[model samples]
Target: MTTTLRDAHGEALSTTDRSALAAYDHALDLFNGFRMDPVAVLAPVLERDPGFVSGQLLMAGMLLGSFDGQLFGMAKACVDAAAASLQKANERERSLLAAFGAWSNGDALRANQLLGRHLIDHPRDLLALQLAHLGDLFLGHSFMLRDRVARSLARWNADDKGYGYVLGMHAFGLEECNEYARAESVGRRACELQPHDSWAVHAVAHVCEMQGRVDDGIRWLKSTQRHWATDCGMAVHNHWHLALMQMASGDMDAALKLYDEAVAPAPEAIALNLNDASALLWRFQLRGVDVSGRWKALAARWRLQAAWGCSAFNDVHAVMALAAAGDEDASRAGMAAIAEAARLHGAHAWAVALPAGHGLQAFLAGQYARCAELLLPLLAASSPLGGSHAQRDLLHLTAIEAASRAGDRALVRAMGDERAARRLVGARPARTEDHVAA
Candidate 1:
């Protein structure tokens, strides 16, 4: 007799192969819980049952998550496998394959649209929902991120297996949309339901970070750090959060120390790790902390990926590292790569890149007025650039510094006052550095 396994929604998987079912279930659990090593778990399943369409779909999505150009070959293979096995899949599985096909072709928006319609018919499809979340993330559709989870919540209850994960995702979306209080509450509730849910932990961390609750952020991260420290995929990012809090408290030494211990020498040369490193070091540079020699190391790592053109956000960071290191050739090449990607991809690729590339180059050249002019307009549309609000805040910080350097005292003061009001700065940090001078 053949055995079947149910997905998070209790719907039976189309596959009856026992090993495939086991691997798929294990992969789902690890993925929904944000545990590490999901791909390793799924790989054997694909090997065992080449006809497993869902396995092919998932493995392809996982490869894309790396955002590494080298992995494109494997991702394409997975997509092709799914396409070849289409006849073996159910209607929903086939629909998912179609979406993955678009995703494999670098058309993320189309894949997301397909997933969106898939959800309208099968709101309980957790796999579809997960992919949709990625789509929202890549598009910088913050409102969509929050609303998509909200739309699916009616079909889930606390008793459901992955309900806590769903709530955690919703909490993150809310935080991205600036709904701090509700985000905190929902995220905390998710953590209560599933202590090991790293996404929930991350969501609450974002709330504290945005609210400028430095003490709260530190305390919460410290208390919950162990749950995600070992097995969670977002561990380094969580540490990055802690470092940000330390920086906000004017503990530059602590921030740098954290960077060395938890961040730099990334486990992988992937864009995600590289972005955090650049963001932190750039913060140091903005504060005139003399991050000498550091940019060279970062730029060296980025040189390997400078030509990947995977994302405009990543390309901009690469430019930052190269420009700081005085590698004019690499920086210019990075810009060229971004322009080509924008041209080949669409407006989504260049909309932010063109301005961001020029702005970064202008800032490096000490043309502060030009930098500010190029960056200010894109601040409101930063979401389309594809990163968390915290990550995209790099643009705001750079703009503020440019405005300060341009002798636009009124603009600088106005921006500072607005940040202060929103951040609820009762007592400012002691250091009055160049980053805050204006």
Candidate 2:
């Protein structure tokens, strides 16, 4: 029932095999799931034809919906390819695409670096304006995200329905900084604007997770997974978050299974990072799992800080890896390296906190004394670490666990009692044991 192009005679030139069908299906699944790796997933088809508008839009949606660390190089490559194709995408489409690309690969500084000069020529150019706002948001500069969106909305509010996209994107950033009130308010607006909007829905999940509504967040994800199982981006990311939330809630069995089913099959970095990958090292430490040679592949991946590396947010795991390999010297040296990188880059977009890294190193080194001393200050400062309250909370909790190990009374109280207590929304008990769950 399959057909193939042939030469002048009628010989078969190529085959429409099952693999091709599966690849196309996979592409569609990626898109529907909200995984956001358009450049990576769609690269094959894209390389075959540059002016693939559908591919561009799919890629754009992935980029726009991005809530994790920036996929800078992949985005840049896609944008450059699309531009080279000269397909002349519409202004709104082009602007948002370029904005995500710059934000991802180029960084806020790079985006600002270009926007400053571009604004002089096209001051009110909506694309440039939107991107300027995005740069401001990430760089923690003075640019107003809502104000810019308001302007854009005023122009297209009536006819355009995608404004939810803008609001949802901003909501994710706000949630990252633990600005729950503002994030929730913005998220409500986004949801009202587009209830079915994947990004808007995802932003709300960030808020829920920050508020320690892990069950609610995971429930939402399960519902979303069912809704977007055919959707690639959403499926992978939703599974990633759900797995982490489960782990945090002490459902290790569920977490591990999800990791294998959802994360192992996917390439997102955060999935591995948040899911207690230290278990891999710990298993090796106990001589239970033969994870010795696993280091070469994983370390190589982490060293580049590429896709898998983004989730390498847990510096402790890195330390554990070095220590597990019988190289305490290597572990110390690696910490110094990451410490410098954190200072230089300042994990504003996707990293946890600098002190969290130090705290992780202490725990990895078994220097409970120093770990408590360093991380107590860190737990106090987690609110300002950026990204979202839940992430900061996780950082604090992780530190507190280390501090508790360090026998630091203050650190334990700060992370365990005070921190958890503050996360209470109602008359609920503060001691949820999320932090102390062995």
Candidate 3:
């Protein structure tokens, strides 16, 4: 008789080693819980049974998800290790490894397709669904974000252990696709089901940001603060959202305070943490606040990060920090890295990002008209940059500020009209007339 262990979704493991199975299950529990330490839990499982294909695939997925250039090597190693054990794995496990292989090899579209196919065959494969959701996020495929989760959600229910997580992911998808009301409702429902579901909390935050509901965002984040702030992997990002809400509510003091207390003081200055710091400080600069030392701190971390330049999205944020810090040498190096990366791995995404990065760098250099000229036309079609609408709005804000500084009344009005039409700038300084005066 083969001893088997099951995942949270009641899927049987391919490994007959009871310890490896238990470790694999433990790893999944950690992942679903958003502990962000699944790799640590899964490491022992892979060691105990070197042929544990499921464990290998899980490790690979987590490594790819890290969004760290250093980890790409690790992710590729996991893919290679799993190749020898492919025959021992199930069909689903084999497909999972294939997706990992593509993603590690810099073919995100193919990875997403493989994950999509795997989900179609096994909608109950929560791991595949989650990986696909992340892949869609990287590809900036907003429709796929919502639809991929929706397609699999029919197979899930409240009775499922990680149902809240699935709902949270779906809510983010819906939020990205502009279904604000429904996204908020579903996100709240997810938080109700599991208060510790940080992704769900973030989904609601995204809705609030998009809808310009500052008070609602603040209240929602505060009310659910403990769940995410204490143990969630996305604690800093959640704080970043709260800071945005604070800034929107005209509370820059509180927002900057949060940055000092929670956001920038990250244990490890990864791209995620550094991006939040750079973005928040940039927003402050736009609002005419002096973030003198903040840019220097952020730029330091980015100097290390710029060496790899694996993703164009990360490259843009790094340039923002370096440019703001007025580190001409680092900025030049970072820009060169971005150009090289785009030239080497230039997809539709990098094409948009490359000019956007140049525009941001130009803005920091006080070349306002140049910034406006570069960013204005590309504003509408900038989705391939692979960030949330809120994150991408930084580009729009930069364009507006650049236009304003250049005293380009026509450009300011054009950008302002778009914001006003969307009700994104009601009677605020971003209003056309006020911005034109600046």
Candidate 4:
């Protein structure tokens, strides 16, 4: 008689070693909490149980999800290794491996479709649910972000191991879809259930930011600092959110302090971290702040990632860093990379991001009218370029600033009025605070 192996969620495991499955479960918990690198946690386990298909898939999925083209080789290796063990994999495991392979090969659409189908069949698969939710997020499929988690909610309950993380994912989706009130409620509940869920903390921060609740956003992030600020992979980003709130409240000094201390304290090769750094610095530039030294340092880090044009979002930020640093040649090279990426990945979001990149360049060059012209048409279509609404607001902000600099007050006012209307809808009054202890 053979004993079946099951995970914490009662999902069957391919590996017979209960200890390996426990390690895998621990990795998933770390990932769900956004506390540490799950790949690091799974490395030794996979070495011991080379046939652990789910572990291999999780590693591959995380590497591909990093959006670092340099990691594609490593992700491909994981895919190849998983394929070798496919004979031992269960149905859900096979589907997950296939999805990871698709993502590694740059077929995100196919990958997402496979993950979605896998989730439908195995709704209890938290790993699949997370990968699919992140896919929706990277593709800017806001509806799917909300609905994907919603679809699996029936299969989950309070007693489920990763229920709070699911709610965190849903909260971000709702916030992306402009359901601010519900997003905040769900996000808050998620945090209550799992205090250390940084993604949930970040989701509520998004709600406050989008609704212009700067004070509330500051308070929310500051109050939750203990949960997310230490050992959480998303610390920089949550701090980025706090810095944005500080900027909105006319506290540029405080924002810069956060930038120097928390947001981009050092150069990192990670595209996501670099994106937050570049975006925050660019916001400072838009306000006529002197960030030249900072830009020079940031541009150096971005130079390390210049060859990886797999992500349009990352490419745009690279352009910002190079251009702001007065590296004209490197800036031009970054633009060429964007063009090349757009030409090759026409079906992807790169094409949508090309104009935005050019518009940002124009804004930097003092070609205000041209900047507005290039960016205004892209405001509505920018979602496919992959980022949250708050992140994409950089484009809108540049356009409005350009119109103002071009002496087009009417255009600026119209754009500002439109933005104000959207932000003010269903917005509650922000409670006053003496100071943000960020």
Candidate 5:
């Protein structure tokens, strides 16, 4: 690791000096540690390597991965750097990276366009095919993602790896459509194509979680996360997800430990801080955990801006925290920002989220009747317009709590009858280590 690879006379490396290298490594380490904002840690490196900004892409990825998109400003300049890097790379790689950058920055349309262009040239660019599939996944463009995967499957003669990507993506898509069996099968095939792939793992998690197979979700989480933990950045993200899972299973203390690890560091504006820290708080509040102090500290630096859709997501989570903590003024402020950046797609996005948020606030306030009223509509909508496993689980869980408190038999019956019947399943031919060497 110490030996120079680029040259002998040029300090044996890139970025002009070791200071920049140290900065980059520090940022990367923090990134791997907790998905915290890499922008803070990366600042020193960016200052030194202004001309070389490909590093910004990682910062954006950390942001996007966490679903807290308010840290885009810190990485805005880096987007240009990344774009420049893409231009400098080979046409195919550039196109793929460009699509990735767009997706990371919360612009699926741009990602779709870039992937589209790349597909025109290489028709079977595996990277483009995957990016296109993902762009559609997040953009509420299910048909587009499905169709692209279909074309890729046909064009590539259904290569197993490519099929894995398509099926993995479709696993989530089917989950969205309440086609749990289809979701499960596709997800399992994706895992078979390349065991240890994160998407494949996620698909499997969905299949298990939706079927109420907690043990299965736990096994998938354990194996997949144990492997990811070797890398600090990936492990950090894993912890974030793990925290949520633990809390979902009523392990608040365990979740808290994970949360502490997720955001114990000094605050930064980069990807690692933004994602890991912000997301930790959001999930805490979502789980009905009192994260008031975290919210206050986080809100101080949280501004509303659309640099990479970070502002919207961050603000939304912050709003949830404030509302739950009973800070009306602060909560309203947070909601104002979130309203603009709210995710609106699928038949139940607004119906589900709006009510769920209200019910959460009410639950926090001990207003069970209001909670039931608000959550009932969402529970009703969710079965028909399903979503990602975690998302749908959240919808049902909130409703369960609300209805149980309110003594609403109809709500209980609806969820049990409509949602429980639908289950997603996924599997792989065999377990393979080192398959996700990203």
Candidate 6:
């Protein structure tokens, strides 16, 4: 007779092997904390028990969340493997497998909707909630980011094992939706509950960055370095935030030092890490900093990912590196690829990817008027590009810089006014050096 095992939330696990269940719980803990690589942690367990559907689904959700096109095949295989165990899985597992299947099939919208429905039935499913929250993040659905967690909050309390993680997610959502004060409060509470929660630390960092608290942002991240900087998967990004604060403080030397020691240090093939490198270097480019060697090295790594056109956000960043390095042929090739991807993928590719890519191209080529023309229109509707508001601010920063270089003072002032309006009342005013420091 098979014994029923339940996860931390009391949800039934399909496997009777207590060891597999424990491994699954451990992997879930790693994933929730953004610490170790959960996929690696579960690989051996899945090899030992092929019928562990929950483990398979967890792996699939993680791979899908990576946003790396190279991992899509693995994600699909995980979905297929889980489907083979469908006869043993509960309804919740089946729903999760179906959602992963949709994501692997390139229907992220469908996958998110499926997860939303699954949550309605199983609000205590922390794994499902995490996958759904990530889907909202990748889809740039700000309201859903806040509301998805909001809808499930009543089912969770401080005593729940992953309650702090849930608050961390909600805090990020609130920040994205521009509720800075509440986001900071909730995020700090999450850190207090789980001191090593890097996501919670990141959420509060974002709040500080957005509110123009450069000194406070630096202090917050530095004070919490012990929690997030050691063996944490998100360390590079957190370092990138610190570098951004240094940039805001007009210490380009400090920012460059952070880039060399903390942010990149070496070329990375991962799209997520590459995005951070390119965004940081591109900021230097906008400031007329001489980092051509860094650009060339970063562009070389980006060239290895030439086949990854699934994410428009990634494609635009690739264009940034290639263009800044003065690799005209590669830059043109990157733009053409975006155009082809747009033609194949429709509205999002066309509206977000193509313009973003070409706008960066123009900006790098000193065609400032053309760059502003291409990117300014995207300011209001670039969420479809898929990234946090802070990440997407690259486009806004570029547009403002382009307008300034083109002698469009009205456009510059208008963009500045828009930025100032979004900032909290006590935040620093938009400085000329922030955008036009040459």
What are the RMSD figures for all models against the true structure?
2.7, 10.1, 2.3, 4.6, 10.4, 2.6
Taking all chains together, each candidate's TM-score versus the true structure is: 0.93, 0.61, 0.94, 0.94, 0.61, 0.94
Model 4 collision count: 0
Q: Which pairs clash in model 3?
A: none
- Where model 4 places Cα greater than 4 Å from the true spot, the runs are 1-4, 265-269, 424-438
**Residues 185-225, candidate 2, lDDT per residue (tens digit)?**
88768767755556556666777765878888788777655
lDDT of 1 by residue, 150-219 (tens): 9999999899888998999899999988899999999999999999898899899989988989889889
Q: Write the per-residue lDDT of candidate 6 for residues 1-438, one digit (tens) a residue.
A: 245799988777888888888888888888888886777789999898777898989888888887777788888998999999888888778889888999998788899999999999998888888889887887778889899999998999899999999999999999999899999999999999998889889899999888888889999999999988867778888999988888888788998998988777354336778888999988887777888999988888888865456677778888888888888888889888888878887886346889888888888788999999999889889898888888888888888778888888788878868866666211122344444343
- Model 3 scores worst on lDDT over the 10 consecutive residues at 423-432
Task: Quote the lDDT for 88 in model 2.
Answer: 48
Q: Which residue runs of candidate 6 sit more than 4 Å off their true CA positions?
A: 1-3, 265-269, 424-438
lDDT of 4: 0.82
| lDDT for 38 (candidate 3) | 77
lDDT of 3 at 411: 84
* Candidate 1: residue 313 lDDT (0-100): 69
Better of 2 and 4 by TM-score: 4
Clashing pairs in 1: none
Model 2 root mean square deviation, Cα atoms: 10.1
Residues 1-438, model 5: lDDT tens digits: 122322111112323455655665555434433334456786666566664433455454444444444444444555666666543443444555566667655665676787777776765544345545544554445456445655555554455324454566656666555566777787777666755445556666655666767666776778767434543344554455566556556677877887776543344333434435555665555445677876665555443321322332233344554564457876655554444444543332333444555666777677867876776665544432222445434445555555555666655556544544654221110111112111
